[model samples]
Target: MTETTIVQYLFKRLHQLGIRSVHGVPGDYNLVALDNLQEAGLEWVGNCNELNAGYAADGYARIKGISALITTFGVGELSALAAVAGSYSERVPVVHIVGVPSTISQKQGALLHHTLGNGDFSVFANMSRSISQVVVHLTDPTIAAREIDRVLRACYVSTHPVYIALPTDMALQKIPSKGLETPINLSMPPNDPSIEADVLDSITEIIYSANNAAILVDACAIRHRVIDEVHDLINKSQLPAFATPMSKGAIDETNIRFGGIYIGDVSRPDVKKAVESADLIISIGALKSDFNSGGFTYHTNTKHTIEFQVDHIKIGYATYPGIGMKSVLQKLLGSLDFHRIRHTESAKSKPPRLVNQEAENSGGQEITHSWFWPHVGNWLQEKDVIITETGTANFGILETRFPKDVTAISQVLWGSIGYSVGACQGAALALKETDRSRRVILFTGDGAFQMTGNEVSTMIRHGLKPIIVVINNDGYTIERMIHGEGAVYNDIQPWKHTKILEMFGAKEGEYMSYAVKTRKEVDELFQKGNEFSKAERIQLVELFMPRLDAPRALKITGKMSEKLNAKMEDTKYA
Candidate 1:
């Protein structure tokens, strides 16, 4: 039997899963293990910080199906906690590998430099357990291969982050390479036939009996890799398909049966009526988080909703446990009687056009959210990877419609402020490896950009070309709309946005930067044949808008959030 080192086995597993690049900042403990990344045919994406690395890994996973993140124990691992937690909340598959102290040192309880002055080495892993689907500490080399495979399987199957503590001393420990011959089982467990058939019958009965039916697609549809099945159902059944905030581009917006985004009360009037008034709504992989559901404002009756989730199926309040969505969806697609089903027409009203009355009437050069987002819909190309930050850009993008095959990455459920910039780097790199021609576009607010702006340097370092649009609204516009309209805490120090690429080490021809305050400037820059539109080189555009202005959806959601916060305070004090 051939023998391999522990790190080699781990990297090979990740490579087998199609993870071409690993994201992380190198630390002392993880240094030796990093050597095997190249040997396993994986490129190391060295990020600016561990937190940014974690965010990048999350984004890469969103694009490439699964990704790996490496960080040293204690301080390094803890810095990535926020990103890892976001992955857990949003169901992104990331293998978070933390290099820990040597087995002998950990056993002897030696106080390490990154430790909390005490000898308890398990503290960091303990902190991560709640956020991870599985936490495995690889102390014994004999079981390290088994544990690694187990965690990787869990991460892929569960579609959530998993933690593995790779001890420094065990990095080079010999492990049997025999297990590598048998690939990890990525298939979903087979659902019980009798229960699945009954559930399918119940769903089909509802569909056949309903006057009007709709399909609501959410994040888990993409995460669990059942998008093909969802699309098949939508096409064959001809039901009006709608995507949630987190699942913006799951369905082609141009499809005749594609209803607009359904965000509860914040949705467009047509979308709201189409979804809420449906006699039967088949919600596939629905994650009804507060923000995703417009502050829990969904008026759709549960009795009329049939939810197909990763683990089970829910038909009119009756839950069928253990029946996964993938197999069930495939089976459902085949069983659906398209001829007998009543297919309702999708809401015909499209999103607002690019023509902005406010800008035209005022003749003001300032780009407003209403104009910018709609204009973005027209400028986007097919198969683009769009990353929106969790602020004004996140909400603003809700108004835009993407071209076919475009992947929109955002932290709607997690709502992390600065996730987009780091995610842009990771996503761009993932696209570079898989599909180089696909453009990666980022929409981030100025305040959010400042949080993870250093990741742009990593992009430049790796020759990843992505268009970075900085929405320079002067401060945190999203925060201002929520509570502190003019509060000092919501403000940020202004920076010269045009010089960012240069400051990040992009030399003259290596990048291009533009400052566009007017609607005309944006139109001209986005026009065909323009250097920015060509995207041959890295491009950064500083988009200027009114500091107090925000997306229509943002205003509604923000006010709702403030009222909820106030009500919570009242309840606590009363």
Candidate 2:
């Protein structure tokens, strides 16, 4: 019979479930448990702050399938709540483990340093339930192993964040480690055989009968880990496909059948017509909100749509329960006859225009948003991790053509600023574990960088080298364009953006920083292939662009938002 402490058991189970590293800050309340993390074969990434740690874990999970974050009871957990909420909204699986006071201290109702000083320890856990898909409080040592497995399974299967409250004393309590022998069962529950067959039959019929069918993928396709199945269905069916902005990397953009990024009305003319006019649109893992939909303007008729979702199979207004995207897509691929399917509508559309040639020809004195993004396409090597922050960076990246094997990581649904930086840390660390030579490239605005820029210290501490390009527009450019063009609130304190690498403790030859305003300087930077491409030194570029300039997509979205917000204001007092 094997045995281990509760903390050791927890970390070992996480390691078994493919979590190679845990992200968080050290807290006095959880020092003992933190000490055991290293012995359990898990790397502990100590971040500058708790929130950034949560963000890093969220990003890491997207690449590695699952990730974990550790924090202290009240203050640390609460600070990381916003990041966890973003994970919940985006459907990224993250296990948030919180270390609480000891059983004796909690039973006596002693005032805790991290608490509100009212002796109430349950308030934060209750608050966490709202954001986490599963919440477990490990007060009983006998069941701690089981509880960890259950919560982690929920996080994996649901593709959402789960919370666990670990009492300090209980973490050191000896528990039977037999549970570690069995891996967490991530397989889907058995679907009703008859219902599953019927759903597959219906899905097969839809696939064979449609003359103008298209596959529209979204973020959930990546989060739910059905990308391979999605790719298979697209190939076997030979249907024209388009990915939402959230799914930029889910499918091969070079494929002939790829229509374009379909962002409702804001989509390119050909892309809009192809998707809206299709007789049967097989939307796989498509869960997006008004922001992603360009103000609820998607023209596809629900009556003609077949959606392979996380929990259910939705086909033309009829919802079949107990069906999942992975199984359903696999079954549909087996039954599909490519000869019978035709992209009657999608075939007529031209390939989506990724770069505007004229913009580059007429280079203004200042760096234009249009020219910089496409030019970036030339510098990107294959298999690089490209992460873009919210605002202009995320939207602008859609115009950039990605090479083969490039993974696009962005917080499209969450739209969280300061996300890409922390995410870069985790992505870089996770990338290193695979032994794959990948460079983590990040594009974030200066405004967002100020929010969580200190997370770079974690990268330096761990010797992770990421090429971070700070879009130094001097303010929140997206917010100014969206609602307040001249508002002082959109302005921010501008730092010498190029000084970041030095400030983060990078010595000579270890890091490089640049500030470029003109297109000439930008070209010169990219020409230094040995400097930028070398994974040994971290690179930072402060790209100075026109403050008022925005990406084509963002400009379109901002106008639509203004009209929608104005309508809302008009109706409020009516």
lDDT of 2 by residue, 419-490 (tens): 989998889889878755888899999999999999988888888888899999979998987888889999
Which candidate tops TM-score? Answer: 1
- Candidate 1, superposed: residue stretches over 4 Å from native: 346-363
Best by lDDT: 1
What lDDT score goes with residue 94 in model 2?
93
RMSD of 2: 1.5
lDDT of every predicted structure (CA atoms)? 0.90, 0.85
Please give the distance, in angstroms, between residue 505's alpha carbon in candidate 1 and its true position after superposition.
1.1
Stretches of candidate 2 above 4 Å error?
345-348
| lDDT (Cα, 0-100) at 341 in candidate 2 | 72
